[model samples]
Target: MRYKLIPFLLLTGSLHAQQTSVLFIGNSYTYANDLPNTLRQLALSLGDTVTVASSTPGGYQFVQHANYAPTLTAIASQPWDHVVLQEQSQLGALPFPVTTTQASAAQLVDTIRAHEACSMPVFYMTWGRQNGDDLNCPDFPFMCTYQGMQDALIANYTALAEENDAFVAPVGAAWSQVRALHPLIELYSGDGSHPSPAGTYLAACVFYCTLFEESCVNATFNGFIDAATAAILRGIASEVVLDDLTAWNLDVDDVDASYTSSTNNGWNAITYTHGGAGTHLWTSSDGQSYTTPDATFVFSAGGSYTISHTYTDPCGNSDTETWVREIVVGVEELEHGMWYRVYSGVPGQLEVRGLRGGEVLTLFDAQGRSVLQKQLSRSAERVVCLPGMYFWRVNDERGNFTSGSVVVR
Candidate 1:
């Protein structure tokens, strides 16, 4: 059959909840060195039953695939979970002659849609080749910059995929990253147009990882390839981990900071009033006490202030929290203004209006100094006061207060 069966090694427990059957439609790039075969092998090793079928004629392009629309139509009729389409590498360089490729792909996609349900997803494949010497590569002069050519091809394919609402397997960039690590990996057999075994392995890994959301690290191939090649494939797979760190959730609210040791790990505090050392302290919210003795200092009235708390982890990671509480000491009941409701015919008491609560209502002078402090209950109606402007402060059981001033005649 002129078909090569490449082996795949897949890790255990790496298969996603939803397994998929895939189809590859392209030229030798899809089958070179048994890329599809290797992908099938990897899927099997991961405990997933993945069936791979490819219809690739050597040197075939999108226009060619369009011409061979019957074969593509037949393939599209199957219950395939995914279909990957690759274009000739150079077609992406310029938009002129290649618009045909896009038209063909779009038509073929429409054909596929007619036969299959709309939910079936198509994937765009990208290919890469080794850079060439500009002097010797004059014919296809642009090929000298292999990376640039690959990028152009990828961009072109990506646009087609986007237009068609297809997913993209960044195989070419994966190859480039590998080449950056070790430059010898080539997709071409000799002329940099066909894929080598290493190139095939990388392509398979990219496709498998992206399509099935499976990890390439533990992929087990069919023993067609050896350990060294498997190791390289695993390394390429690890490169896909570029997206792993984004999975972590970090939030300040998740950490508990109520105890001293807790503060060391997750909680900390800051002080504004006292100039003394360690006035602000922190502890873990886990019911542990502060390792160091600390006290919240008494604040002064009308004094500008700043109070803050900070928490940190062992890795020297930290965040700060702050609260500003101004202290107006000796704030009496008169701190808040008092008014009598005219219709009630009763003098307004600080406690009744919620300005000052409890049996005691103390008046404070303009200097915040206490003038006359009196204890009044809710039953107290007539408040006797000398004529003066006094500040009245009222507080609830929770210590939250509403304060105003009253002029007693």
Candidate 2:
């Protein structure tokens, strides 16, 4: 369901508490060194809470997990905010158009959405082998080098995310950046396939930034790495994930700043409402501002006002929208000392009084469409119309103008 806010009298600062629940599904790549728990600890250090659960067995594949009972059971166990899907390390780097892996990932995403419509399915893009895929290098020469393998993984994961309408953690992309900037750092285990503590730590940092949509630069949980190395890893994660969110499809579900407005007393008692996933701020040209998602403004005077609403997401991404409206309040005198009044007490009629002869009076509907225009020949007139709000303007022969609004019930 979309986020909604009700009208409130008081405007307060927006406070956010970052809390998330995630389910990890993969093989050794995800289970090695307990990546899920590492992410939870990392979040704890940053004053956030992350509940984690996983289903990882040795050498598991996306196809296997899609049909696996344990995976399905975990998905139905609770409403998770995110479901991380990590294919076997080598499967994603296979030759182009790996239909089986892509199809299996799609199937899993379908299951995830069926269980919880709001659960965001994220593809955990893993890095290539430390050296290369010697087994597949003979057949597919592209897998012979670490760079080639990493490139394939990046492409496949990005494609899978797009096809499944999901998000990508881009761990492999960050891994490549780290390898280029800090070649001395080792990100692989003894077999050159599994992740060492450093490798898992880097992956955890990437996930922390991806799932929370926030930076992990100052995270206190080093996760078995020295502070210096952890800091370097965190920087890489930020550059890869936060720098270009659209590249990884992270901005697909960003907040929308559009809103709806209504008023019963012309411009006064105007209420603005919105449905978005973040904090809201409403500002007016007349120096009025409110920090509520939905608010009612009671203006004493009426004129042309430009109102803008800005919505900010949890990750500090924001969007602003503006609207200009003309408002007419109760009866008021014009500069030439001519006064006018609008009354709707009579059934199905608008009784406009105190009008000078030979004045041009125009009636506009709620949508600003001119419904009636006439040159008045008397001091009083009654206009027959349906029940609704309308704006009326009177222009005198001497170039003086008077305007107001009336609601016919």
Candidate 3:
């Protein structure tokens, strides 16, 4: 049988080039047990220069940060290459209760823009503690489940980053990946709020890897711990890719069963029912196979079906795979130019821009009405008559709108 192979992109050699100075603004998640220091050490070992300037109170949220915007603005004004920010874990998870988190995130973005040098990048930091652990100390229901809170936090960070044209460092997902691996990593300390040394090291590893786009090896703790603990720490410090299975098959009469991938790779699986009783299952990887408990299931003739699978890597990386199959039916060809191109001025921002280019460039409103038209030229940037929301077609000779959004302010 022919199998489809998914290529893996490794970061083996890309990180060895340049050194960078980064500023970390977070609470204990960023400074607990000198994680910033560990990050500095890791960078030094890799022959990179890394200095961590941090302002982390014990437990602070974006709202609190906004209250001290002047201080944050001052810190951000410095000539740092990258700035990292982490919100209180609970605030990220339960943003509804604290509605100011979103506003605070926006305010922070504005402050960063005002203070940062041109083109400086901002990275949102993601975090996770142990299951059922409440670091916020209020003991609220929203802070109860690790998985639910983590999902909420990730969603908030993703939205905030997209709105402000920023990047994210998914450390919380990385923690989940490690948890899936051993189920006993215990990212928290005895109280289950603060990170243990191992947990801190893991966070540092993520920061180092993402910031430098490199791998972290030989992260040994100082003499503060014993040898056995150190060995356990080393074991957990290592990174690995987990297998992601996209599809599975079972008899029509059986209830659903859950299967984990060997590593945390992403994949999709689909099953087709045939002849009233037969079920055929296929996964994203051609080599992966699925079978029913009994050989009684098959795909139904002319039936269409699809399934998608997603997984997080050891460092909290995520991807999705889709499985599609039709029983004895020819696939439909996707027609070129059937769909119009869509563009946003700034993601999550109030303004969006759209354009279509050929011999001339045309801009359209959200309603697809042409609002402005411009002539194309080799050296001139495409100028829009009005701002707000517009969509651009890609057929023009000058390349279509740039990949990312534009901010008027």
TM-score of each: 0.52, 0.67, 0.51
Minimal lDDT window, size 10, model 2: 1-10
Name the best candidate (by lDDT): 2
lDDT of 2 by residue, 331-388 (tens): 4434665456666757788776777788888889989999998888899988889987
Error of 2 at 176 (Å): 0.5
lDDT of 3 by residue, 212-252 (tens): 44445544443244555434543433342111101100011
lDDT of candidate 2 at residue 33, scale 0 to 100: 93
TM-score of 2: 0.67
* Model 2 stretches astray by more than 4 angstroms: 1-17, 259-302, 306-409
Residue 265 shift from truth in candidate 1, angstroms: 46
> Which prediction has more favorable lDDT, 1 or 2?
2
Which wins on TM-score, candidate 1 or candidate 2? 2
- Ranking, lDDT, top scorer first: 2, 1, 3
Candidate 2 total steric clashes: 0
**For residue 45, what is the lDDT in candidate 3?**
54
